[model samples]
Target: MLAALHLIFPPRCIGCGGAVTDDFGLCAACWRETDFISGLVCDKCGVPLPGKNEGRAELCDECLTIARPWDRGRAAILYRDTGRRLVLALKHGDRLDLVPPLGAWLARAAEPILLPDMLVAPVPLHRWRLLKRRYNQAALLSGALARAAGLDHCPDLLARPRPTPSQEGRGREARFANMADAIQVARRRQGQIMGRPVLIVDDVMTSGATLAAAADACLAAGAASVSVAVLARVAKEG
Candidate 1:
């Protein structure tokens, strides 16, 4: 039966609609174009650095200067090329089928910060945006990552009480200011976050303002600590 189904609809690459041996995978050509982050990275933001891993935590120039509320962070890929395409598809194109592969990537990236008792949550979308999008990409990624890591998932741990303008084209400080006080822990779910280590998941981290807001809310809710994971990280061009 499965073979017949495969014959009728062969598995295709997630990046491109080309036939592949399995589902939830990128073809070799697309895989080559994807910039998966590995080796030395900023301990706070997960941007790839220019050196070998020496068993030490290092911060990128931005992370060094910025005040990051989260204790640690990791990103599965650099936000460009195939990575960018995949993220946009999941976020705006409603490519829900991409969740499994993206979640696996997130789980691998987040391994460095995963704890046995960590509670996973997604940066919440504003009610209006959620209504329009019909789904929260971060929540989908977070749930899949939680399952992959065998951690507890709490989709409603955070809430966005009001909508904020899009952060696109905004400077770092501007973005941060715009996101201030925008997100908070939901009152009903406070017990799930209190005294627990929380990992906030997001689709992408550009200025990181959104993540900072979410992390702050976790800390304010008495979470023991906060960490972050994202499918992609936007790195500055040299």
Candidate 2:
């Protein structure tokens, strides 16, 4: 029966649409193609680098220059070619099945550093953006991570108070300025999130502005701490 089903509806790779078995939704070739970030990573933000000694440096140059509101952050992959495509597909392509594997990756990457009392919340998109996109990618990712980690995932707690310019092609400082004050913790859910450690989830982290702004809002609302988990991180240079 299963064989007949496969014949009727052949399984295709999520990454490259090639034939594959039922594992991670990616064919072997596509899986091998992914440049998973490993090796030396920034202590405050997980940006993997080469050289064993690099990890001992304590902080990345960028993070050293500026202090972020969030305690720290981590990511599973580097935001390059294949990583970019996978994130776009999961967000704009309506491939919700990718959530589980992506979520599991996030959980694994974050497990060692995660706070025991963390409550998960996705960085909210503005209502207009949400309407255009049809779904919140961060929320979906957060939900999956929460299930895997056994933490509280709250979708309605944080909201974009206003729409901001696209951070793409913007300078880091500009992006930070653009996102500051763009988010607000929902008054109704404020009680539920306050006094709890919060982990903000996002599909990607580029300038670190979005997460920082979100963390600021969470802290302002009385959250004890705010950390971040992203599926991918844009390279420091771009």
Candidate 3:
């Protein structure tokens, strides 16, 4: 029956829509174009170090200059070319089939951050935005990641009370304020999340303003610690 279905709908690459052997598989060209992160990365922010220090852990300059609220963060890929296409497809194009592959990458990226007792949650979208989109991409990513990592997943651990505009062109201060004003602890779920180390999942990390805001709420709610795992990291500057 599955093979019959495959005959009806053949597997194709997520990035370029070329034929492939399995769902979520990228074609050779797309895979080559994708930039998977490796080597030494900032211990705090997860961006790659510009220098040759590949084995040692260290802080990025941003973390050195400004304190970050989350304990640590990691991303599987750099957001460009194929990576960006996959993220956009999941986020805006309703490519739910990409979950397994993206989830696999997230699992690998988050390996160093995982702890046996840590609770998992997604950085949430406002109700209006959720209604329009019909599904929260972050929630889906978090669910898959939690399952893969054998951790407890909580979809309603956080909430966004009001909607905000896109953060595309916004500066750091504005983006921080927007997310700070939007994200909060889900009222009834606070006690369950309290005192637990939390891992917040998202599809992508841009300026990291959203993650920081989510971390703030987690810490304020008495979470022992907070970390982040993203499928991709935006490397370009505004």
Candidate 4:
């Protein structure tokens, strides 16, 4: 039945809408266009390193100057062109079909950072936003990631109790302020929260404020550690 369905609607390249070998498979041209993040990167944030390595787990200039609450982060791709398009499609284009490939990418990106028995969760959506969107994309991504990474997932474990203004165009300070007190660990999950490392999943990470707020809440709830994984990361401007 599945093969028959595939015959009826054969898989096509996500990047170019051209025919591909299998579902979520990129054609040669699309494959070349995809920018996977790799090589030396900032030890903490996972931003790709430029010229040469400074040291193992070398901190980027931003990391040197500013501190992040999460102990580590990983992103599958730099947010641009193909990568950005994939994320936006999943976030707003109702591309539910993209979840599996994106989730797999996230799992691979997180392979080095994933820890045993760590609780996994999506950065929460405000009720109003959730209502409008009709689905929490992050929850879907986190669910797939938790399964692939062998971690326990509880989508309701973290939440946004209220709506916050859009983060776009906000300065770093403004973004932090807007996200302050935004994420809460559920009271029922107190036992799960305490002493357990947690991983927050997201679609794209720009300023990192949202994940920081989520990590702050998790730590405040007595979580032993916090980290983040994302489908894409907005590259630092030079």
Q: Identify the leading candidate in terms of TM-score.
A: 1
Highest lDDT: give the candidate number: 1
lDDT of 2 by residue, 1-238 (tens): 8788888878878788788877457777777767676667776677875568432545677788988788878889888767778999998899887888888888887775678878999989899999999999999989888889898889878999888988889987799889978888999988988799999999998878899888998999999988898999888553
What TM-score does structure 2 among the candidates reach? Answer: 0.91
Give the alpha carbon lDDT tens digit for every residue of 1-238 in model 4: 8799899999999877899989888888878877898877776677788767655676677778778999988888988878888888899999998899989988888888889889999999999999998889999999999999788998988989889999989998999899989889888888888899899998888888999999999999999999899888888667
Show where candidate 1 strays beyond 4 Å: none
Query: What local distance difference test score does each model get?
Result: 0.95, 0.84, 0.87, 0.87
Q: 1 or 4: which has the higher lDDT?
A: 1
User: Candidate 2: misplaced stretches above 4 Å?
Assistant: 1-7, 53-57
Off-target runs (Cα >4 Å) in candidate 4 are 1-5, 51-55
C-alpha TM-scores of all predictions: 0.98, 0.91, 0.92, 0.94
Clashing pairs in 4: none
Candidate 1 matches the true fold with a TM-score of: 0.98
lDDT of 2: 0.84
Any runs in candidate 3 off by more than 4 Å, and if so which? Answer: 1-9, 51-56
Report how far residue 220 has shifted in candidate 4, in Å.
0.5
* Candidate 1 positional error at 27, Å: 1.4
lDDT of 3 by residue, 1-238 (tens): 8789889999888888899998878899999989887777877767776677656668877779877899988889999888998899999999998898898888898898898789999999989899999999999999999999899999999998888889988987888777765789998998988889999999888778899889999999999999999999877544
